[model samples]
Target: MISQNTIDTVFETARVEEVIGDFVNLKRAGSNFKGLSPFSDERSPSFMVSPVKGIWKDFSTGKGGNSVKFLMEHSQFTYPEAIRYLARKYNIEIEETEQTDAEKAITDVRESMYLVSEFAKKYFHNVLLNTDEGQAIGYSYFKERGFTNETIKKFELGYSPETWDALTKEALGQGYKLEFLQSTGLTIPKEDRPFDRFKGRVMFPIQSMSGRVLGFGGRILTNDKKAAKYLNSPESELYHKSKVLYGIFQAKQSIAKQDNCFLVEGYTDVIQFNQAGIENVVASSGTALTPDQIRLVNRLTKNITVLFDGDAAGLRASIRGIDLILEEGMNVRVCTFPDGDDPDSFARKTPYEDLVKYLEENAKDFIQFKASLLMDEAKNDPIKKADLIRDMVTSISKIPDRIQREIYVQECARIMDISEQVLVSTLAQLIQKDIAEAGKKQKQEQKPFEVHRNQKPKYTGYSGGDPEDPRNGPPEDYPGEPGYPEQQQVEKIDILYHLERKVIEILLLYGDKTEVFEDVFLRNNGEGEIETVTEKKEYKVFQRIYLSLQEDEVELSNTLFRDIFTGLIAFYHQNEKFSLEQYLMRLQPEFAQEVTDILMEDEKVTLHDWEGQNIFSKGKSESISQYVTETIMSMRWFLVDKIIEELKSSIVSNPKEDNMELLMMVMDYSKLINSFSRKLGRVMSRYHT
Candidate 1:
């Protein structure tokens, strides 16, 4: 367990913007910072970080929290792992409570795999830089490829020794588990014994976006016919080849700053371009580009320029990826090197200025590239040219943004010297066909399950009818028919979600403010009938909200929200002043995100000028007492309404005399609901005017 003192120190020292900036590129948006969401693919910035609150919210994914929660969500770290990571980053001394042996035994498997990979990376790198065989073979190989010493070390280039069991034996000697080693693909297990997977190959470490070493890519030095030339780490929990980009850890900052990314095809291509002073580049690690990889780039920038080799095969490879990028709603530009060269060779042969100038001068819009490439093959043949136009339309249809698709169509029309109408019509047909195919595929994937009545068990002497009988269902006296209870439960959950959230929001924002509230009571003044009395009572925001819910014996329906509410009430009982920062620090990551979202929702709304658009005319803090009372009343009214509906359903379904009592209860609840509804309406009416 992390000590509370250490957690406090970490929160005080750690800056929200600084921690999130390590992974996302945030720019100042007034008092806050805004960036594209690292959790989702989006063009506009929806991720906001507030230094004052020490919290961040990604509106795209609805995940928000303090700095520690951000790390946990983005890095998939456990709570303790996230705390330790923040402690290290902020240089805070961690005073931890000692755990038992059993507690320590349940350490996270993923973190262990991470540890083994980190050790393997260091071992391979040390071997390359210090050992004679590694210096001679690995160091020499990198130098031969025009990579300077600084570039090699910057990328953490390494070499595995030629001996089969060198890494495996060293890891076991160091107390590292063989299970972790095999899981990371650092050591391959055989029937007899385990051996190093990358023996005799120069290694390239594959890192996560946060720069943790997940796995390695190794290049075989020998020209043996049976062995593959290049091999990557097998898919593991730590390394997913399709979801990762080669230089994302190095290039994410530059990609965000430049608002563009250069897509390439190999590890060397990325390193070479960075060495040539073009920093915002990532490679697909020699696989077909995937939507996951595209989303990774989309988090940093909305524009991508794919660099293709001038050769025929590279051109074909580039064409296959263009549609995927377009479908993601990114602006894609295509740049080709001189026909004989790839990005690696070209970057090596040219000076920095010449290389940069070449890309700037030659990068063409994807539509233009497609038209130019295919026009040559079509060559004035009317039939072939028509087919080429249809092909272009197919690519256009893949685009999710209609405006971009239209612009591409117009460009194609101008280039092909054809009417825009024809191209537009063709694109429409292709889009409709795509939608139909998608719907068909969804239906095929979701086959309905057939439930047989004979499979159900029959219960004896139950008030409700037999389980297997379709018509005899629940007894008439039970809660309305079969589906009514489920429908009512769904309605209650949906209603309570927003209502409970509103109450929580009120307490979080203005919980410490003291306000005057009107309380109604009944008193007898030496008379037969009791006289109604209205008394003014002063209470803190938190006290009023807590008492209102307590008075009704109400608890939130959602487990996470209810837990947060219970914690808030407990804290209010102890502390006179509520501190959001301190509260967030003590919160568990799962619930902390929920609190952060509630706290940051208003800030984001204000930042985007949505608050001033007459959408929510009543400010939450304008009339504190009224706001709290209305919110609590709204929830009470909703709950009462739900009860009335359930009681009415029962009264109609059950002919028993017990229903007379239920009908009276429903009548009283309806009267209370009406009174509350009218008061809420009056409050809303004040806002509208």
Candidate 2:
């Protein structure tokens, strides 16, 4: 119930490009900006944004709308949430209509969860910066690790107090619910008592790409024998560990700009890299890599460098994540620090120049890294060495890109001292085995359903009867019946689709074309009495259609043709001289929906990227205006053609050449139809080539 004025202001102030740019890396293309589709896994750019029109279109998925729609689709934000987000971004004050108590109650649950999460972030941050225990422990720990005050605050590093129930009591006192606290995993419940979950740990807030605090990761400082060093919030409605990446909110821009990402294992690793002047780094928070996490980075960059601790066991365990990255078609490289150092320690010990230089010099492609690491363990043992080669081949087979896979095979063969042919043959066998196993599993899953259908045979394409009439009983005698008339029915559907498209195209291309009808008589004169000798039938029809529209007092200027077309025939009975531009300008949403429905009903039509061809100014006002005009003209011709066909049928049925009234109507309709057809034909002639 935000005031209409507030909504308008938000829309006006929130530039579509600026709003979308925060999440997407957009590059200029003609009059629009083009980028890889965030909604889909696309390698090339198909998502477009038109700043002038204030709309965006994802050509790959066919989703297009204004800025609000983009937020709703991309972030799963509700309409009000999108509006509120815009309001906050643009600093607009919102005036909302008062809601009933029941409505407010329903809203409180979701809003309360968000409020509680924000409150916890603030509380943890304040405790770290202001309190004695937080400073003495958490702050001191971070500082010792070479994290400056700015770095600590930038990452929102904080400390949780040691006392159980401290956060719980404070939150409850502030009118926050225990349920919400537990739901976000900030507090835990046990046998009639609840306690703060992250008590006595240094805090790292895990955030969504938009910077909302979804959850936290906390590291314990104590050396208690039973205590786990690091802990994170449990899975909740807002935070799914498998799908979230730590520090993505802060690192997305740098990742996009660099065209590469540095993946690490923990919060300190990320902070150290950022402090070392490398900003395109994020941590998986020590979990197994998930496709959701991969895609999050994939949206920003296609190249990833996984930084592993130098220890052999850690390196061996982390190699599996590299295969996952390859499977997603991302380019991956591996860099291991010296045996004693992790990313954090290594980055802290070396100067920024040296650290960056070391990464650039030492990072190896996944294939070579896997082979070299495995070869060392299998040294001088032929059987184990053979197994190592097979393992490397299997990993290479998972890569989706054929060229990349081939290159890896050659590299692997060279490194392992095997023939290229031998490696290729081994990869083929492994791939076939994988495919066969997958097929067997699928067949097994389908067996139960197949058994249930054994009693009744499923319909195949044909029956024993004559194919001429599919509905009729099969012909008992003819083994080869004439094929059912599918071709004819398909042709009819094609014609219908084509006709509608052609009509729409013409309207969108040339609806604004003007024509002069002069030296035309409205009435024919007889010897004794006055009679109307209607001019060209098409012209008269156009006049009647035009005049009729005027008589109805309908304003057609700036109206979207799709809407006015439906009402125009009726309006044509009274009015004339309705400008096409007026009809197009005022097109309502329903009309736009109808046009889209019709245009997209058949196979997708690719409107060539005029910008790429340097044909027009991208998303210019003139080009869009011309497109709308053509669409209207095309639709008008379609309607006129229908009218002409009906009138001709009427003449043949009644033999009404002598019936002046009938003749006049036929003449008028024909003239209008011809006039519209000629105008559309010219436009089609010009653009179709």
Candidate 3:
């Protein structure tokens, strides 16, 4: 377990901007930093980091929290791992007591695997720099490829000896578990013994977005015809090739800064571009580019320029990736190297200025690139030209943005010498077919869930009688109560949702502030006279809200809002003071993010500081007593209105003998609702008036 003091120290020392800026490129936006959301694909910047609050919110995904939560969310690190990462980054010493054998045994399996991979990465890197064979072979090979010493170390280049058991023996000798090593794919296990997985190869460690070594890619130095040229670690707990992009850890900042990413096809291509002064690049590592990988870049930028190898095969492979990028709503540009050259070779041979100029001048939009490449094949053949136009329309249809799709269609029509109306009609047909197919797929996916839900017992909570039978109306002698049950599930507009949400939001934001409330109660005087007595009561905001809800037996309908309210009440009972950020630390990430959204949204509306904005006739903070009363009363009014509507509906639906009783019930409920509305109107005078 992490010591509380150590956690506090880490929190105090770690700055939100500094911690997150290591991975995301943040630009100043007033007091906060704004950038593209790392959690989702977005073009404009919706991710905000507020250093003053020590919290970050990704409005795109509704994921927000302090520095620790950001690490946990972005890197998939466990709580302790994220905490330790911050501590290490901020140079804070952890002061936890040593774990016992039982405790150590209970450590997370994935974390153990990560630790084993990290150890192997460092071990392999050290061997490359210090060992005799590594210096002679590995270092020589990297140098021969035109990589500088800085590039070598920046990528953590490494080597493993040809000896079968070098890494295995070293890892075992260092007290690391064999199970973890095998799970990380660092050691290949056999019946009698285990051997190293990347023996006799130079290693390139693949890192997560946060720079944690997840696995490795090894290149065989020898010219062995039968052996594979390159070998990557098998998929393990920590590594999924399709979901990870090579060099993302190093390239995310540059990608965000440039507002563009150069897509390449190899690890060497990414490194070479970075070495040649273009740092915003990532590679598919020789695998087919996937949507998951494209979304990774989409989080940083909306523009991607794919670099091809200047061959027909490379252009064909590169074209396949353009639709995937377009599907993510990203702009696709294509640039090809000179004949007989690829990204790595071009970057190595060309000067930085020339390379930059070449890319800038040659990069063409996907539509233009396709038209230029295919025009030759359809030059004099009208039949082939029609096919080309259809192919372009298919690519255009993949684009999610309507304006972009239209623009591409216009450009394609002009290039293919086809009528614009013809292209538009064809595009429309394809899009309609696409939507129909998508609808079918969606229904197929939802079918199983629908079946399960239908099989389960659903409760309407009706006391008696079939609700569909008009003969059985509401009970004539029904006691009209404030907390009345629903007659049947009606999906009418519920105003109480927003009111309940407001109450919860207020409690979360100003729950610790002391406020004086006026409480009125009925009492019997000695002369058998009923008198209204008023009492002045002092309670914290959270205390007042909790007690009021408890007294009225009111539970928020939204489960998320109810959970947050309950948690706040419980927290306030234990601690006299409340801190919003600290409260967030104790809750789960998803719950904490919801609370953060509520709090931040309230701030955006100038919750407590609305007075200077001239939007409120009265200061909210100064009129705390009235504010709380108004919120609760508004909620009560909504409930009364709901009941009134239900009663009216029931009376109209059931033309039975109990019509007189139901009418009286409706009148009485109407009177109550009118009283509540009057009270609510008075309290909301600042806005309503």
Provide the global lDDT of candidate 3 against the true structure: 0.79
Candidate 1: segments with Cα more than 4 A from true spot: 1-65, 69-81, 89-112, 177-183, 188-195, 349-354, 440-506, 518-535, 542-577, 586-689
TM-score of each: 0.65, 0.62, 0.70
Best by TM-score: 3
Model 2 local distance difference test score: 0.72
| lDDT tens readout by residue for model 2, 585-607 | 23343454344333232212223
Q: Please report, as a residue range, the 10-residue window in candidate 1 with the lowest summed lDDT.
A: 456-465
C-alpha lDDT score of every prediction, in listed order: 0.82, 0.72, 0.79
lDDT of 1: 0.82
Query: For residues 1-689, what per-residue lDDT tens digits would candidate 3 score against the true structure?
Result: 77888987887778889989987899886677878777666687778888877788887767788888887667656678898898888788877667888776666677788788898989888999999999999999999999999999999999999999999999899999999999889888899989998999999999987788888999999999988999999998789999889999889867865779998988899999999999989998888889999998887778999999978765755587788888888899999888899999999999999999999999998999998887777888889888878888999999866767788888888888789999999999998998788997866754543423213222212333233222233333333444344343222223555677788778876788998886755465787444546688998888888888788788887677788788888888887677665676567665767667775663332322345666654335767767888898877776777777767867766977578887887776676666666656766774333
Q: Look at candidate 3 and give me any clashing residue pairs.
A: none
Candidate 1, residues 1-689: lDDT per residue as tens digits?
78888878888889999999999999998789999888666789988999999999888767788888777666656567777898888778889677787766554677799899999989999999999999999999999999998998889999999999999999999999999999889888899988999999999999877778978999999998788888999999888999999998889767865779999999999999999999999999898999999999988779999999988655755687889998887889999888789999999989999998999999999889999998988998999999989988998998876667888899999999999999999998998888788896755643332224332211112223223232223222334435456345445556677888888888789998999986745455685334446678999988888888888899887677789888888888877678888777777766786788788877766557675686653566778887777778788788788788768766876776577778778766766766676667876665445
- Ranking of all candidate structures by their lDDT, best first: 1, 3, 2
